[model samples]
Target: MIIRLNDMVFYGYHGVNDEERKLGQRFIVNLEMQTHPETDSVIKRLEDTVDYTKVYAEIREIMESRQFLLLENCANIVADKLLTDFPLIWKLKLCIQKPSVPIQGILKSVEVEVQRTRE
Candidate 1:
């Protein structure tokens, strides 16, 4: 089974610049998760599948927990936490977007993506 969560926005203090860490900025996260449920029968109960609510809460907690210098670090933490917390989730793709990047050129956003699977 697959579960997807898209456009999860959060304001966080993450960047290399001091101003960015102090001011913070909006980050959009997209997640795609693949899970394996016991048996191929119809999944009738919440226990049979991964609870996305818990996943969201866990992600929010991680995002808001502290400041990081790179989005890659944040992505790694999210992937690690989710995979560790939920045993059913076998793989995941995570994308994090920094909408307001303090750079020289005008661009839509800067993004970092990572994929992880259970070992």
Candidate 2:
């Protein structure tokens, strides 16, 4: 089964510039994972499948734990954490968006997407 989480937004200090880091900004995160239930029969219980609430909590923890200079690093960190925390998840895709980037041009947002699988 495939599980997706979209537009999970958070305020964090992550950027190359000091001002951006100090001021912080809104970050939108999209996460997708491919996995299956431990049991062969229908997944009737939460214990048989990956718990997305726990996953969201983990993402929130990672986003709030520290500062990152690059969104790539941030996404990678999330991917690593998810893979480590849930062994049943074989593949994952993560996207992070910086909506209020300090750029001269009028752009909606800057985003980075990353895909990872258990090795």
Candidate 3:
């Protein structure tokens, strides 16, 4: 089974440029998690599965905690946290995006993706 959330916006200071880290920017997070199905063979309930709200809250907490110099690092942080916190999850793909980046007006945003699997 898989649980996924796409394009969730977050306010964070994660970038390489000084202006980016200082001024901050809007970040879009896309998380995809692969996990085992809930229940043994009879009970079927959403509550039996991994609650995405908890995962979202964890990600939000990270975005609000400190500043990161790179989206790749932040993405890795999220991926690791998910795998660590949710033992049922076997793999995860996390993508972080910076929208309306302070570029030379050539592009709209920049994004970084990281994938992690349990050992």
Candidate number with greatest TM-score: 1
What is each predicted model's overall lDDT from 0 to 1? 0.90, 0.88, 0.81
Taking all chains together, each candidate's TM-score versus the true structure is 0.94, 0.92, 0.87
Best by lDDT: 1
Query: In model 1, which regions exceed 4 Å deviation?
Result: 37-42
Which digits, one per residue and each the tens of the lDDT, describe model 3 over residues 1-117?
A: 778988889998878889878888788999998775443343267665667889999999998777998787888888888888877677788888887676777887788899887
Ordered from best to worst TM-score, the candidate numbers read 1, 2, 3
lDDT leaderboard ranking: 1, 2, 3
lDDT of 1 by residue, 30-119 (tens): 999987644326667988778999999998888877899999999999999999999888889999999999989999999999998887
lDDT string, candidate 2, 1-119, tens digits: 78899999988999999998898888999999987544435666787667999999999988876899999999989999999999878789999999998899999999999999877
Weakest ten-residue segment in model 1 by summed lDDT:
35-44
**Higher lDDT: candidate 1 or 3?**
1
- Model 3 residue 3 distance off true place after TM-score fit, in angstroms: 0.9
Lowest-lDDT window of 10 residues in candidate 2?
35-44
lDDT of 1 at 66: 82
Kindly report which residue stretches of model 3 are placed more than 4 angstroms away from their true locations once superposed. Answer: 37-43
Separate clash counts for every candidate: 0, 0, 0
